[model samples]
Target: MAPRNDTAEPVAAPAGAAGLAAAAASHVTVTLAPLTEQLATYLAPADVQRVREAYKFSDAAHLGQFRTSGEPYITHPIAVTEICAGWKLDTDALMAALLHDVMEDQGVPKQELAERFGGEVAELVDGLSKLDRLDFATKTQQQAESFRKMLLAMARDVRVILIKLADRLHNMRTLDAVAPEKRRRVARETLDIYSPIAHRLGLNVLYREFQDRCFEAMYPNRYRTLQKAVLSARGNRREVVGRITEAVRAALPAAGIDADVYGREKTLFGIYTKMVEQKKSFSEVLDIYGFRVVVHSQPECYLTLGTLHQLYRPVPGKFKDYIAIPKINGYQSLHTTLVGPYGTPVEFQVRTRDMHHVAESGVASHWLYKSSDVSLNDLQKRTHQWLQSLLDIQRQTGDSGEFLEHVKVDLFPDAVYVFTPRGQIISLPRGATPIDFAYFIHTDIGNQAVAAKVNNEFVPLRTELKSGDTVDIVTSPASRPNAQWLNFVRSGRARSEIRHYLRTVKYAESVAFGERLLRQELTVLGLELPESTDIAWNKLARATGANSREEILADIGLGKRLAAVVARRFSPGADVVATTAAAVDEFVAARSAPILIQGNEGQSVQLAPCCSPIPGDTLMAFIRLGQGLVVHTTDCPVARRMRAREPERWVNVGWDENPATHFNARVDVIARNERGVLGRIAAEVTAADSNITHVTMQDDAASSVTLHFTLQVDGREHLARVFRFLRRIPQVQRIVRIKG
Candidate 1:
């Protein structure tokens, strides 16, 4: 085998330079022996033996390789496994963690690991492996594809992500050896992506550590300043934190509550984010000290909260009962901010010991699983639910870049927990709408959602839901995902599903149109359109570099491959006829055939809002990527300008001559600024048999006002009638249609 280049571990100082120097001053040394001893404290004899074997194999495989820090490559895997061991993962997870880099760095095959250890460990190792073997067009694409594979692996087995997080955590910890630019890039990615994942998984320790490390790597100066500020603040607030901790400890005991109370300082990154978001100075951010009370039972957690509230007045709107309604990631706690000594706010987190472990370790809280706590099932179920959602998103989003984007949107842990009609808690992204909630309930509900009732009052489908809101969705068989829903829906699954349905419907429609256009052109050449089995169509597809005849036809319809070009391919003997201008004109007329536009078109057809073209107006079409065909009036300056720049993209289109639905038209009416002038204009528009969709006015002077009315009318004739009525009004000075 060719010598494998192992680039998994960065060469930078794994530990911060300050920490390393401090350790050196203390005459401390670290090695795999200490890590092995730590593993021995948790793992059974057989599991320990397996880990030892994994280490030996990894060490041998990476014998010739070294990290940028000039350490044997073997140490990186050992450190990663040590992190996993801290989580007390299963033997398979630890073994996979030890061998995580082998497959990529040492070219060790999955089959080999499966044979040596077991399939589970090998699968975990495979999941951790990158798709470096395959070629990608750009580094971004390569990274996206790698993330996609890793995410798919995680969905299958949550352990994959847990192990991956450990691997990244270690890399981030020692990222000082990497080149400055690369280190910043990695740190930014860690901060943006991995830290959120850790939070979503409920790994609070790793999450905090990841953020701190990323802060240090990305903005070392800012991190040092913040670190110094936090340290100085800690000294200044030591008395305050002590008082609050003592108060909680004293109150809990007096209330007969058995709990472990400790002061929790905010992470440096946390403080930095607060400073940036809230625009506060370090001195102004006084609520940086908090207290955590770990109780023996769930009931005791509530008691602890009550005891603490007795000590300090609870801040209104700051108390959250997450114990009753855990976060989507299965984080359970009673969170409250209390007005402490000197009127400073002091936050408190109260949870059971098991809840604490899960809150910190998240899904990797193996102790909870081992203890047979029912909450473990809840954690697993929630993790699996989110993992399954990834599959659903993946199904709808075929493009790797789009899938990554949707996943990133989901990684943000900020969520609002709402309730369905039946009291089922439905957690959604903040700013999520009724449509997002309906989809989270079920895709069918989303597909058929027509109206929504929040707390028994009807609201728009795009109404942003809030926590504790009881939302009742009214669905209809005739209703489907509105294109407008895309504007308000916040969840990845909702966006992907909506886009997928629209794309599928558009593609199916375009296929039909392409087939018709091709057949019409073929008929013009006196040739019969061949069936799918016809060798001629298949040959034409191959000649056009298309996979199938349908693809060629669809491309023709989409204007990617011209119908005339395909027609020429199928009828090679008609070259002389193709050169004739009249024949080309006939083919063009047949193919164009005035793409009929109704008011209601899917994402494939957009009626240009600039001109507000009605059915009676001459229309032109421009094909936009992903937006399908956009219709505009022939005289629309915006459309004309676009056509001038790219004339080939414009296609002939016309209104259906009698559109069933009313079209929106804009008219400017200059009216005298009078008290009832606006009311009279609306009454006249209503009297003219037109509904005002929207009206905007600007005061041209003290007496004159220009009102822009977006009125719904049948066509140009109806609009003209409304304009005439508006012109007759005594308040109206002049009326004219507005065009782009």
Candidate 2:
């Protein structure tokens, strides 16, 4: 399990005024009064009383536990509850916040909490608890599983993550008492996982706080130094800031704009990140001055932008209109950089009051303020879609570690927006390819994607998309995801779906291949293949500890178990089958035919790269343990060496008479070192109807060069034609097919 905060405790009955005074006098700190007062602002009296009861129950459950800071354990839950109250969350969320750790730390049952506080509160608390009872090979695996659990729960109820983030925030604020090494670890995790999540959800307030707190915990010295520098810079920049603020304030009202304008500085962590990423000194980072203009309506946001531009020349190409196309997290603002006093760059963000609230609180705004605004509804819908994608990714991914990896990949904040063929806006992470876009539309589209058109022009599926590009995916039912797609796909959904398809396909292929190999071996043993309903098959499965017959075959197909050894399990008299080598050889010669190879055998059969074996080549296969069959040319040096070492692994394999797909063949050309010589060779190869997949050239002498090319061909006949064509070039001296 992940490291838990030592700060949770159960609740007892709420301390009334006199009870609070008595507890305070006894030095038992009680924080229920302030929490109740905060809740009273938004919640009804009955709801507030319920929250108080939950706090009391939690306090009692946590009786004598203490945090690393030596505070009563109940203080942590109250602090978390206070954060939730500030968001004006519902009474049940507050109750869950107060009792989130009881089930994990106090050993309190979820059933008991449900009976007392209702199922919603109990479920919320359950989501917050880690899976501590399960044993894992490593802390990372355990933490991943626990995170998977919590995130799935959060997907079902957004309130769960809200409360969880509050819990983490409070814990981070009190991290000083933790041991130094552990502090650093927790800080790193918060920065990598929790902070991005907070940002992805549009909780900029929590996100910034998480970053700065983590920065402080992980690098106290750098944080302190940077803090001092910021403070010093603040004094020096005050006059310029005042001038810009006064100029903006004075200009806005004259333009009939009702707005609240204020100057603000960037966060310490934000500044530090800029300096590190851009490789600049503090003084070189000139755009630290930030201003916000809050207006009454969305139209005024643009009007305010024009007013700001009129007051100060807007920096060219530094303006972004996020209002028209809100960010994926539902953040909407018009951002512009302008030349302030003395040409110093000053950044300004203009948004309406509602946008500002949503910008600051993110998804929390959906609950914090009850409104019928379309933007808020859109925000909620977008958040739900993202959460639903998480569940989709988890279902396709088998391991918790892999699921966490996909989620992290999906948490990226910087995105490029594109349009579908139907004009629907789709946002993906920056550097995302067409494959990611396809998957973003639907898994089926992604699985069968064959080609793509970006802005009416055909492009490779791996092309990185830019904002405003309209993309159309061309899919075919015959097309399937290639393993190569995993290299460039940016979306988590695409990666997981492709992997799931490949795994399923590979297992099926393995089972079929295993059956063929086992049948061949049984024929050589003078025994017939067993039927599915045969008793011998069941007995064999039991002896191999296999769950089913297919599993046993899959093992053999994957080379996990030798087919020769398994063939004896079906024979009534293994001694008779092995009685004479001469008899076995004669039986093998009469009945065992070589396995036929099709180019599209998927993962069950692989053609060796050492010697690109195409159809018409004499090929031998080696069954590598747990890796299936690897096909190699008969005379390949590597194959000869492997045969010498493990002759038993060698198998007879022959190419199918009519292979459907093209195969890769390597060719070497010795040509004159002329500028147009390489181009001529390429043209000749193309003229021969072969595609050059890869090429490399190196100078072999003063006037000659050696060129190596990998070409896609139907078979050796097509490859020979390519060689024959290349040999006609005036610069070409000698041509040879590379066999090894």
Candidate 3:
């Protein structure tokens, strides 16, 4: 067997005076020799030949191009390919890495690449290529669209992102040669998008490198100052680090556990972030040391942890057993922070060799080792599951910008492990609500989720989930996603699913409402709507430039077109009659009688907050353009002004016999400013079978205050009952509903 080489092949000169002299003397230039030599160790002869052929093709394609550093553009592709090679990617990935930019920059067609290489390689290259041909209104939109395409492609094939990351890594390393503005832009992009992605994939080594490089580029002065501080701290702690390293090395063997132990320092960016986030001084942040212990087996990992704990006292609540419940990214280890000599904090990570490999390489470990170990297989499975979710988000989201937003939400690294009622563990992002947890289990469950219980205690759906909590979702057939869910959901899947359901429901409601309006106008004209197969329907669709009858109706319902105009088009030559006052009254009654205000009307019908209109309140509706209906109380000031300004837009509306959902109503109270006054008022409101959704306080004087409360009530009767209950309180001097 040949010796193993894990380090990446260097494509450029090292940074230093000695390396510069060597480069100047030899006129060092990038060549395929070193990469080919490295490939021979793992790849077949035929595969190596294919990579060489790809290199030649890419070199010719980029013949006259040069990078900002004045190096042949081919060097960039070779460097990316070499980086992929370090991951032990297959031949197709290697070829794709070499030709990734050809389609975007060289105008090489996809078909040509498909003919030259295999279809897989061509597809991989296409996935890495940006969507530059289309025009966008803003630079941010264009970037988002391009990123959306690349990520969707990556969801299908993981190698696309792997190669893209390698490409980005090389560009970042040489970013200093680019313009300062461009350097900052690229650095920001890397920090915001690529670094999180790397961390999400469990490529810790690459993730750390990206953060450090971006930090240096974004804040050069801060980076230099922090570098000096870290170095100074390192020198001061050398003796302590050496002492701990020796203790671990000696103790592990004595405990009959064979392990490789080494002291590790936190990355520069990581240290800086901790200082900023924790608001600690450099010395305080640097006092904590890190170490890694790689054992030969999983059992030995725990044994090694025990040996280390015996040497130092373990800190309370600082231990995490990832080995038992692995991270969503498939990172498995036993991490414990301990108090070392001189009361300094020491953090240790214990894992087996395979676990260590998976932790560092992430999904790439499957190809790097070519082993069927459970750890590697689990890593691949977890990565595939996450990628599949990306596809799900893409399918539900319509806009590229929205898709990118969803993906960015999922790229967060912090996760909390929770459980279902059945005891199945589900990992979600920190601050995730029960809505996110429900969505994580299944989309259908999420759409129908009405309530949830955490640890057998009923909690709000928007309650932030904590690790180890057993969550049981309560679903109902009639329950659907509320638009308010978008405010609290932390997962991409949950947000996308909620938006998709609302959009679908809104469209259907619009179509139905539009049809009703059209029917009423046709009644005024002594005509009836044609059947689906009627020739008149097709004619009306064509004349109105509508794709279908439903589309025309939707336009009318959305207030984009007038029902009267559409009805007139249906019978253009009919004698027109001037509508009489009695006729108008009858028409108004007919239109308003059937349009009942149901609280669960989705986005098509919104109750105007200006009036807090509920059931039993005489209501009027205004169909604003593209926003189906806005219902309001008859006496609302805003509704009155809108009716005066746009009389034609107003529609008569009535409430259903029973509203299915709670409506928000504001109550103002002048009360004594005594202790527990607010609590008593809240208790009274709740006792009246109403929920207080919001509250605000205003000081009227030192001993008197005005309190405002927003309560969720079923209807006018419920509001009356709440008032009666509040009137019973002696501290409440005055109470009245606030109507706008």
Best of the candidates, lDDT: 2
Off by over 4 Å in 3: 1-28, 372-374, 524-526, 532-548, 562-600, 608-617, 633-650, 655-740
Candidate lDDT (C-alpha), each: 0.79, 0.84, 0.82
Best by TM-score: 2
**Estimated TM-score for each candidate:** 0.80, 0.86, 0.82
Instruction: Using lDDT as the measure, name the better of candidate 1 and candidate 3.
Output: 3
> Against the true structure, candidate 3 has what lDDT?
0.82
Candidate 1: count the clashes.
Answer: 6
Order of models, best TM-score first: 2, 3, 1
Off by over 4 Å in 1: 1-42, 367-369, 372-374, 444-464, 472-489, 518-529, 534-547, 560-573, 576-604, 610-629, 632-740
Alpha-carbon runs more than 4 Å astray in model 2? 7-25, 372-374, 450-463, 470-479, 523-527, 575-593, 609-612, 635-649, 657-740
Candidate 2 per-residue lDDT, tens place, 334-443, comes to: 99999989889999999999999999999998778775453588898889999999899888888999999899889998999999988999999888999999999888
Clashes of each: 6, 11, 0
Error of 1 at 276 (Å): 1.9
